[model samples]
Target: MSVSEREKSYEWQVEDARAGQRVDKFVTAQGEWSRSLVQSWIAEKRVTVNARAVKANYRLQRGDRVALRVPPPEHLAVTPEEIPLDIVYEDADIVVVNKPRGMVVHPAPGHHTGTLVHALLAHCGNLSTINGVYRPGIVHRIDKDTSGLLVAAKNDSAHASLASQLSAHTVERSYTAIVHGDMGHERGTVDAPIGRNPNQRQEMAVVRKNGKRAVTHFVVREKFKGYTLVDCRLETGRTHQIRVHMAFIGHPLVGDPKYGPKKNRFSIQGQALHARTLGFTHPRTGEEMTFEAPLPQDMVDILNRLRRESGL
Candidate 1:
């Protein structure tokens, strides 16, 4: 491989849930590459497990570190669209947007356009390339059905700083969610580890072994007959962390399709969750910053209806 391709190397530590899975399958599950491509890389001895080149069918063991030196991408086009963005804050270093529900943060399979990244390309023109061409300037992501405040870096320095803050667990991120069961207590914390569900590769779950540490502190803001509005603060960000943690505690978000019950009472799409608050330090100025976004109309309407039904 070329030096530039070597510089693009990626690594992932195998968790307990992924133990015994084929190396090619494990690498392909990352969503960045295809199985055939991964197999080709393995044949070329570009993929390694624990510093040793492995075959495509090599079964990964817990704690094994997998590394792959990927070739350059094949002209994946991400066209800039004229989609409107709800700008909450903007400066030379960063742009904060209030992304509405149903709008994807970045492009992926089956969601090529109408994404926040496409809109940002048109609005800002220049963004940090740290996350590569597909997710330029994106530091973090909320699910497609989630609405909230998210920041994007305009330059590499800004992206590095924001990413460091997130890794250090210093960024302040809080969300509002309506859960299915009424909470018996006013506040509590769910401290668990999250990892990919072994049975269902596409889903995340609270796992007892080899999972990354995830903590969520929540307080009941309001309660209805069978639901509770709660505030959730994330200590460590994981994919589907809040949804998985809430469901682990037996109070999954009202409209959550993956983690919650199959049937839902609310007509809203996806989870009844909104990222309401975000705080971080400015990369250039070393200044503290925070932003808040109100709940979307659909969530507000549901709360209002719940209050009326409960006579509260």
Candidate 2:
């Protein structure tokens, strides 16, 4: 693939404040490019420093001329919809919202509307376009069924900062889940490698080869006669990471459609997993902040039922 013929080129002159910074990283922070995307452009020779093709790591001097050509996004026409959103916090840099169960984060293959992006577009029109046409402000993704607090970047700088924190494994994310079986230990860790399932192409599994390393630390919060409530801490953010890892440990989350048991015990809509706590440094201020969201009504109702019927 190549840059589109109608590439939009951005020009920047490095100032004293940005002198000595790496060219790719400097451009990434300037609100138009992502770090990885900038690096890719540098490799493609679409980025030039001082009228010369330079490496991604090239340091910029004051008044250095930088030109970058980026492909224009497809006019997918993701219209703004005035869907009600559970806004927890909002600022110029970021907005934190509690996504309810059953709402898609962004446009999938065929589906485009009714997603969090659509709502965000209506709520906050100015969103970071780093993620592309569909996922404008999305920094990370929670499953369609798992309800939780998620943060979105309003600008590219904030997006880059948050993405950097996630990559460094410094972001804190915790979840509460009701697993199918009684966990043997009070606390445990599942250290495994997860990759796309070889058998089922749509699913993820603990594949030995070509799998990314994943780890989940769990603590038994409350135990019942047959089920267990556990708090899970994620160290890696792979697709379906918590669900796949918990299932690997023989205690899949209850109501998990793709990974749970076939027999019906709980008439839950989706996985009994809730993202409870999320923590990260502020993109603009560098302040460490954490937020938590309570369990949804469905999960709460099920837990109450379980407590009354089978107390442990």
Candidate 3:
């Protein structure tokens, strides 16, 4: 990575500010950076009011020019280690990958190395830079323990189109999961809205307000003695929506540490969720495309073992 790419700057002018407004809030509203980022810059003395360093709580007057510098996130140089990748499909516009379990989708916090992003960087140089330094070509994300099909955009135009499709709920995504209990019904829909849990910030929950609309449709595929295999489709994407909704209905996914029962029915470290299919239209060509990935051997073995144990 070049040193030049590690820093970015922009100028802003505070206008018509009411008295008693803090400098950080005034500058943040006038600039592209978020308020939290602005506060950090003020503390670091990277934000200057009329070429003078000021505290975040400094009062703002009219026509104050604020200069701010935001450093690029600390990123580990991506090395193309020869990690095996299951390339389901690839084209000029996009690439489909069968991401395996235990692989983080992109670099973050403790997982700065050995991520899919690093591998993609090595495999395809100069991927779409729309997602910034951490995620070069990523369009969507699957949790680290959740294995399944994922798409990557190779260029900016492709990224823009795919992102639009996702936002508009045009992209089709499907998953297969093993949940804790048998769903008596053949099929059902969960239309509960989801948001961050008020009590537990780390988890998501069904909330009435301060939540986004989320709908999940599920069909019972196979029923074991105490568990059910379900095919799930998403109508809206919210963080941890499927996991939270299923658990709310008393059928947490097997092996799901966060949402499942205290005693996990399966031996896997993460949730028993697999992104089985993905479909989208090519941004440039406008042709529809779809891809499917069979369940990983671990999930298959676990199901088979449960069946045999139940004498089914």
Candidate 4:
């Protein structure tokens, strides 16, 4: 590897004394570094061994020499622009934003600016660069067309604390969704493994061996003519976990262009899913904090129309 890839990096072998321990703990013990630093490296996806990125909880085997390459710190520029944002809540540590539909959380290829991060940089000064240059303060993200509450960390300390909460599954993330067909059960849970689709690189699939555990609990809030409004809580956050699981269970999200049918029984632009609520322990104050975003007009209108037709 190049020198730049080695400066903010290190390598160590798993001695017999440290075998069978968690990778993060093993790395910390071997390097004399703080556990928090090791955890950050894990979260940043910087630590690898034998050309594979392993999770922090991965058990280390004896004689396993892990190579870590920490990239250079991203220096983000704060350029102000007139990007409109719906600020939900703001504190010294974090910002809760009610992101509108069709807003990308961060920049990707072909989408450099006009993102929530760029807008945040324009509105707020500097943000935590924990996730890297592309996403400064983004702790979590919603889909481009999915609207609702999202939290942005303002400093590294807050980012670390929030990351820990998310890692421990302490943060509460709930979504409101409209799915086709009334579920057979009033409430149900989907415990399935999710991993990258082997055949389709762009999608996620349910796999037993190479997949990560994902759990989604969903309850039917209201039923329409042939659809259902459900509340979903994420026990584990994975890419498209909700959509994939819901689709897997034969209740694909309505208006979902990717997973659901092309034409919904109703007319809508995108999937009728909203991040209705998010709660977490405040990093600084050690107090429970929660934020809620009511359904967007499109969703509200869809539900209202459904209710009107159903007369419920």
The model with the greatest TM-score is 4
Which candidate leads in lDDT?
A: 1
Candidate 3, position 190, lDDT: 96
lDDT of each residue in 1-312, candidate 1, tens digit only: 665544477899999999999999888776434355579889999899999998998999999999988767444367889998899999999999999989999999999889999999999988886566788888899999889999999887898788778868999999999998889999999999999999899999988876889999999999999999999999999999999999999999888889989997777998999999999999999999999999999899899999999998
User: After TM-score superposition, what is the CA distance of residue 72 in candidate 4 from its true location, in Å?
Assistant: 3.1
Measured over all alpha carbons after superposition, the RMSD of each candidate to the real structure, in angstroms, is 6.9, 5.7, 6.3, 4.7
User: How much is the lDDT of residue 184 in candidate 2?
Assistant: 93
TM-score-wise, the better of 3 and 4 is: 4
Worst 10 residues of 1 by lDDT: 29-38
Q: Candidate 2 clashing pairs?
A: none
Residue 48, candidate 1: how far off, in angstroms? 9.5
lDDT ranking, best first:
1, 2, 4, 3
Compared with the true structure, the alpha-carbon lDDT of candidate 2 equals 0.89
Model 3: runs farther than 4 Å from truth? 1-79
Report how far residue 301 has shifted in candidate 4, in Å.
Answer: 0.7
TM-score, structure 3 vs. true: 0.77
The C-alpha TM-scores of every prediction are 0.79, 0.82, 0.77, 0.84
Cα lDDT tens digits, model 3, 127-152, are 67666667778888989999999999
Higher lDDT: candidate 2 or 3? Answer: 2
